[model samples]
Target: MKLKTLASALIVSGIMSQTVAAAELEISVQNLTHGNQFTPILIAAHDGDSHLFQAGEMATPALQKMAEGGDIADLAAAVTGAGGVTSENPAGGLLFPGAHVDSIMLDTLTMTHLSVTAMLLPTNDAFVGLDAWEIPTEAGTYTLNLNAYDAGTEANDEIINGGGAAGTPGIPAAPGMDGGANGTGVMDGSSNDKVHIHPGVLGDTDPNGGASDLDSRIHRWLNPVARITVVVK
Candidate 1:
């Protein structure tokens, strides 16, 4: 029994040691949307067993807050608690269209996986995500174009209200100020209760009265709304 206990302790020590090792990584994200804004981005490097958000799965409480509002506090704390390295809001504030933050350098020695998440403004619960992407060990720069995702935490009401908290009914704010007002709302409920690819938004030209507050011509985007470049140094 004593020998078995000793072996277990040694195994745990090995794991803890590996987790403290670091990998040098320079990371950045660019917003490709024409007019949309990305809330503070969260970039993390963790083990394969952890994930910030996963498609086809229900979002966690932390993720729900982020997707519904531009809140990264909870998610960042969660990642740090999970034995991972994280960079929050590298751009200092909203990452505007065509804008990028390239100064993030992560020494993710023990962490082998990478993920990024940030809420897209001018809509409810819409976010861009990269879930548990494996960080390549090879010394090269990797570029990935990411798609928008819905946290499935709120209905895409397309209304801009001051409700940014979790379980709120509307979008908190739209920095672009291009969205309309007096929107009746777009949907009564979310069709899917799991994180999934955003169906894109439906907006009308009317600003005074419309089904959605977002401007279709300005807010809509194709796949790959954000570009991520990771350099393994």
Candidate 2:
């Protein structure tokens, strides 16, 4: 009788351990830019079938708000409503270039995928995004490189006029304060009306009057603007 009781206890304990282990996940994000700053970032783990944003599709109102103004409240609420786990503004504020931010251990057993987004400062409607990455079941760390995406909700005016609201035509502010002033906008027309890879800022050398309000040499960047790592334990 004693032996049978011990075997049953061991089986129950093993089942509980597996349940606990499957619920927890760890995720980390890094701002890999050389000169740009990332505004408040939003990290979420949702159902594998759901996505925060998709390429070649119109930006959701929440995504547009976050991309244009660096606000993540709405996006957080949206993800929560869909039964997802979320960590909002993990950096508290701007994640400076080359800075790293880690999310608190997230128990996303039911949530099978992850998504992240943050606006890139000193540009109009440009954001770094990770959409619906499948979290592996094995215990290991996975790294991914992210690209800069244009929200396509506003023009790339590049004017730092403190206009961050949706539908505004100018950049909110240059967090680094490295942007120029008093110049014409970059492009009056955008070919893509949906979310797409950013064409990068078209900055000029002049600060007083030029085609762009950013310095060409200082603001330019190639693809893969951000990096993210997920550790499944």
Candidate 3:
């Protein structure tokens, strides 16, 4: 009886060891914007083929929802359905300017790449994104900077009217409390219909009635709107 019990114990220990052998990943996301805020962020560990967003490509329905409405449920669901590990909304809510958020440890033994995306507040269909990045097999720390991309799904009217739905014509909110009111709107038309880099907000000194509701000096940002660091162990 003692020998039989020992054999069973050994079998259980072996099974546990195998489960623990899976790869462990640590991901950190930092908002580099001086005035913008990031909506719920979506981090996924997927295969090389998976991409959260691609430049010059048509934005998916999920991507549109996220970029326009600050919603990440659809994207997270899509990633989860693809046999990928996901950390949804690690920040719990809006990540303010110059803030950082860390996700839970993701065990990605099978998934080999990582992707992340979040909407830039006070803008029309603009988002900070990182497409599929090959996670190094060798354990180490890696850093990357991300750029802001225009969803090209909306016309960027720059009118802050609480419009946070897909196909909306104006910005939803300016969480930084630096926005103006009753502006004339940025442009009357949009020339680009494909995803591309954001041209930055155009604001005039007149806040009560101007071409933009945002302050150009406070809201404008260059490329690489976010910084990401990944540690694999």
- Model 1 alpha-carbon miss at residue 149, Å: 0.5
User: By TM-score, how accurate is candidate 3?
Assistant: 0.88
| Prediction-by-prediction clash tally | 4, 0, 0
Best model number under lDDT? 1
Give per-residue CA lDDT, model 3, range 1-233, as digits (tens). 99999999999999866643456888889999888999999989887788878888889989999999899999999998998889889999999999998755788867878888999998989999988988887889889999999988998778889999998788999998888888887774667777889887776677777888888878888988999999888
The residue-level lDDT of candidate 2 at 188 comes to: 54
RMSD over all Cα atoms, model 1: 2.6
Ranking by lDDT: 1, 3, 2
Judge candidate 1 at residue 70 and give its lDDT.
82
* RMSD to the hidden true structure, all candidates: 2.6, 5.8, 6.6
TM-score of each: 0.91, 0.89, 0.88
lDDT per residue for candidate 1 within 161-186, as digits (tens), equals 87789998998987988878898988
Q: Write the per-residue lDDT of candidate 2 for residues 126-149, one digit (tens) a residue.
A: 999999987777788888999999
Question: Of models 1 and 2, which has the larger TM-score?
Answer: 1
By TM-score, the candidates rank as: 1, 2, 3
